[model samples]
Target: MSQPADYRDPRSLRSRERIIRALRAELRAGRSLTIAAVTGEAKVTRQTFYNNFDSLEEAGWFALLEDFNTLLVDDIQTRWSGASPDFVGLASLRKIVELLRAESSLSLLANGYRDEAGLTGLAAVMLSEIRRFRAEFGDPASPLAQEEDLYTATGLCGLLTVAATGDASSTSIARAAYALLPEWMRQPRL
Candidate 1:
């Protein structure tokens, strides 16, 4: 016998959601996430937090990813659904940059990861999802060769890191990303 899709106990989901929300709030407030911090924020015990996540980074990354998924639903997935790949890719990238403008917390997540653990496993997973989203939703006029895709993804993440560390306003960050990201995206075409 097989279980149906979307099958999880309500209690478990509520507990996890509380933990994620707590972690997210902490990081957004410019506080680095710690086991103690998250447990206190979530009103959960050390054992409960540990049972849900192996480490603080894992929880942080998961919370960030969940937020990304929501952003995708709000801006990219719904609006750009069924649009051409090129259109989707460019639009999504622009939206992503715009999101950085709108949400300071996202910047916290991006730059925070750089120091918490350089090139973390959670980061790789998030990158993979980003690259996949662009590939699937925003295909270029011409197909990108393997290396080109890698470069584009790397450049985008690197730009995010730079933006995250800067003391500029979200508007300034958005402007710089708008100017630079297009050039980087164009590289694969050249």
Candidate 2:
């Protein structure tokens, strides 16, 4: 029996890459992704899109997460290259909340309260990125290191959901969410 094609396959990777590029283009152009829009942007058939992603929302989630995190992580590194790792990550997260607030309409649409399925998908992506960042900065000896993945996923999801709701929260979200980080990961007073 032959192995099935996976994302690692060259052609499959190319197809997925085009689909993601198309998704990003639609979002950057401030267009909602109708099937036609995605297919047109990707220059691939509708069937190709479906083959790579289960739904349009899933594709959007992947594209959004990839673009957002790539920029955010780079910004964090540039701003705090000399600072301790945890400080940089914490600051970056606060910045993320601010950016989300600034892009209120887009954030609201992705929040998915009106569309429960979308909420789950977006939250999953958010949690995955946040948790990955946390682990990168996490203290190996801290209790947090041994906790289940749900610790960061559920906690950050809840925090971000709340942050998304407050219209006047850009400045305050940083300290609020930063306080939730494990004690060992926090920056000490000067």
Candidate 3:
């Protein structure tokens, strides 16, 4: 017997991409980020938007995390040369600055628009990412490594927050974040 034909719709995928792009455009333009604005900009209906995401803030966070994952997860080896801790930190910061320069609006909107609970949630997410990165690449067996990971993640998040809310350039913010990285990341695994 012949198999049934597959049924799939590409319109939903296209609509999702359009919605994300519209959200980014709104962020870049420093315009109001409302469902109506995003739906209008995306030229997709509210039903389409809701189909993709629950809310505008959810969409923004998804985009921000997606960008960071692309940079951190996809290019881990190339970006992280297991050399001196300072070198890795600087290189990572440089790459982050490049990302921020390319599309900082997402970060700005994600960090700036959130309330206390939202900000706490974002921090927790960032902390989890840092812990995962350490477990994957650094010395997770050491207690010091765990503590250092928390410190570095907290400091970096603070720096990003300051840069997002203040007038500091991303380059400067990255430099500050780089300084917060501990040298223990280069410690040899026992």
> Each model's number of backbone clashes?
2, 0, 0
lDDT of 2: 0.61
Q: Which has the greatest lDDT?
A: 3
List lDDT for all candidates, in order: 0.56, 0.61, 0.65
Model 3 is weakest, by summed lDDT over 10 consecutive residues, at: 1-10
Deviating ranges (above 4 Å) for candidate 3: 1-14, 79-85, 101-104, 112-125, 139-151, 164-172, 182-190
Cα deviation at 112, candidate 3, in Å, is 5.7
Following a full C-alpha superposition, what root-mean-square deviation does model 2 have from the true structure? 5.3
Tens-place lDDT per residue, model 1, 129-154, is: 54555564445444653445455446
Model 2 pairs whose backbones collide: none
lDDT, model 2, position 58: 64
lDDT (tens digit, per residue) of candidate 3 on 96-154: 66665566667655554343444432454466667666766667787677567666766
Q: Whose TM-score is greatest here?
A: 2
Q: Please, what is the TM-score per model?
A: 0.60, 0.68, 0.67
Candidate 2 residues lying further than 4 Å off, grouped into runs, are 1-4, 28-32, 71-81, 85-87, 102-119, 139-148, 187-190
Consecutive 10-residue window with the lowest summed lDDT within model 1: 181-190
